[model samples]
Target chain A: MKKGIFSGLIAVTAIMLIGVIMLTSSANIKNSGSENIAQGIWEIKKEWNNARYLLDKATTDALADSANTGPCTFALDAAKVQHYYMDTIAHIPGCTQAFTVAATAQAGNYQATGTITCSKKISNDFSIKKFEKPAVFTKTVSVQKDMPAAGDCTVIITDAQSGLVEISRVV
Target chain B: MYGENKTGKGFVFSTDAALGIIVVLIAAASMTMLYAPDSSWQKIFQSTSRSMADSAVVGFYMNKVPADMGLETEIPAAVKQGYCGRIYDYNADNGAPGIQSAPMDRNYCGGI
Candidate 1:
């Protein structure tokens, strides 16, 4: 009787060991496959966020450049905005916080590569190599409001008896 | 006779204990296999993937990604890397995706 009981116990232990091994191996395989799919999903999500971020950054940068650095006075500089927006998005060289957009279809071709430290700086290179700081894109500089060089008209009159004076100035 | 009966009874109890232990182990293994990603779990994963694709389509819209570029350049480029799907212009009949009528800056993420 003692011998029979001992053998039965050994059989039960073996069965348990086999079950444990099978369960562990199955779980490992299942987890690895799930991990791969999860990684892929995460990558796609990241790319979408990056694309959106690039677009938003361009818009904000363009607005800041247009409002702060103007090719016009009391008006948003459309030309500057357009130039800044295009150059920022297209990754034109010589722009602060900018990187190159590779023409090839390789991965991460348009990845941003530098720390952006521009505080209160709203101007971009605008890809205008012929003229740096051209008049139309000069930061914090206004077109001369008092430039009356094109034409000027002035009239002055004084009445002799009443000593009344009248003046008209238009430029 | 009584001594033989006692030994037999002892042997039967030991065998019963062994069988009970085996049953317990098998039950535990079956429970684990049950939790593995079944049909419903797969559906969940597919739904999540589709949602991510939808977000990418939204990025194409807003004209930031350039809808024309998405259809012309990106979809093909993405497809090369295990990506599947087509970019359909929003509510178009003639399917000119020919300078896109009225600049429909709309996109869908997944094919189905």
Candidate 2:
């Protein structure tokens, strides 16, 4: 009878050990996946913020001149942001690939949750460069209204052609 | 015959100690994530001042002057009372060239 009780205790200990191993491995995997997604989200937000800053700088500088008007043409100074994006997200130890927007389709307005695929665009070298190769990233983003009351506003991006994006208005 | 085992201790885990340690660790981590005092103040002043100044700059560009004016010039004057007063000279000559002067120079930041 004492021998049987001792065997049961051993079995319980073995089961607990297995549970510990499984839980630890699963937690590690889950953390890694979450960190990757977080990195992608950061990349996208940083890229967009850089774009906005460039636009602001260009417009403010152009404002000093008399020739510029409502919409102006400025080379997308994407190189600076792109280079950083590549080095950080691509070269990192665990990062698989850089985030991307879909090809044949442009990045639509910011949404709370969505996907982004990579696309090809002319690099600063003027030669064809695949941006963040395997240029496809799909991620979720949260965007809120960016306008004041009593006035309607839309973000317009233009160089040769114009792209006007409308944001949500909760009111 | 079944008998009670009086000599055995049921469990050894210290639930209170574990919970207290976990709570302290979480609080420490959260505090580490919080902003430093100077940075926190800068963020507050930056957002408020930038919004005010940006709107003022835009309005000046668009010809939409605010009614409760004179704060722009007053700010520099207030600074003059505490400093070398070089800002007074800077305030005097800071208007945008070729653009029309604001409706009132009374609110100018630099001396006018």
Docking class of 1: incorrect
Task: Evaluate model 1 with DockQ and give the value.
Answer: 0.03
**Who wins the TM-score comparison?**
1
lDDT (0-100) at residue A23 of candidate 2?
62
Model 2 alpha-carbon miss at residue B10, Å: 27
Give the TM-score of chain A, superposed on the true chain A, for all candidates in the order listed. 0.33, 0.36
lDDT of 1: 0.37
lDDT of 1 by residue, A1-171 (tens): 454675577666767776786677678666656655554444433333333344334422332232211222223444544453354433322223332221124321112222221212112212222211101111121223233554322222222223333211121
Candidate 2, A1-171: lDDT as tens digits = 342354355445545655665566566555545544443443333333222322222222222221122232112223332333343332222222333222123342211112222222222223322222222222111222344443332223222122321111121
Off by over 4 Å in 1: A5-15, A18-171, B1-14, B33-35, B38-112
Per residue, candidate 1 scores C-alpha lDDT tens digits across B1-112 of 2223554654344555656667767866676666544455555655654564555555554544434333333333333122333222322112221111221223333222
Interface RMSD of each: 15.2, 16.5
Model 2 chain B weakest lDDT span, ten residues long: B83-92
Given the true complex, what DockQ would model 2 score?
A: 0.02
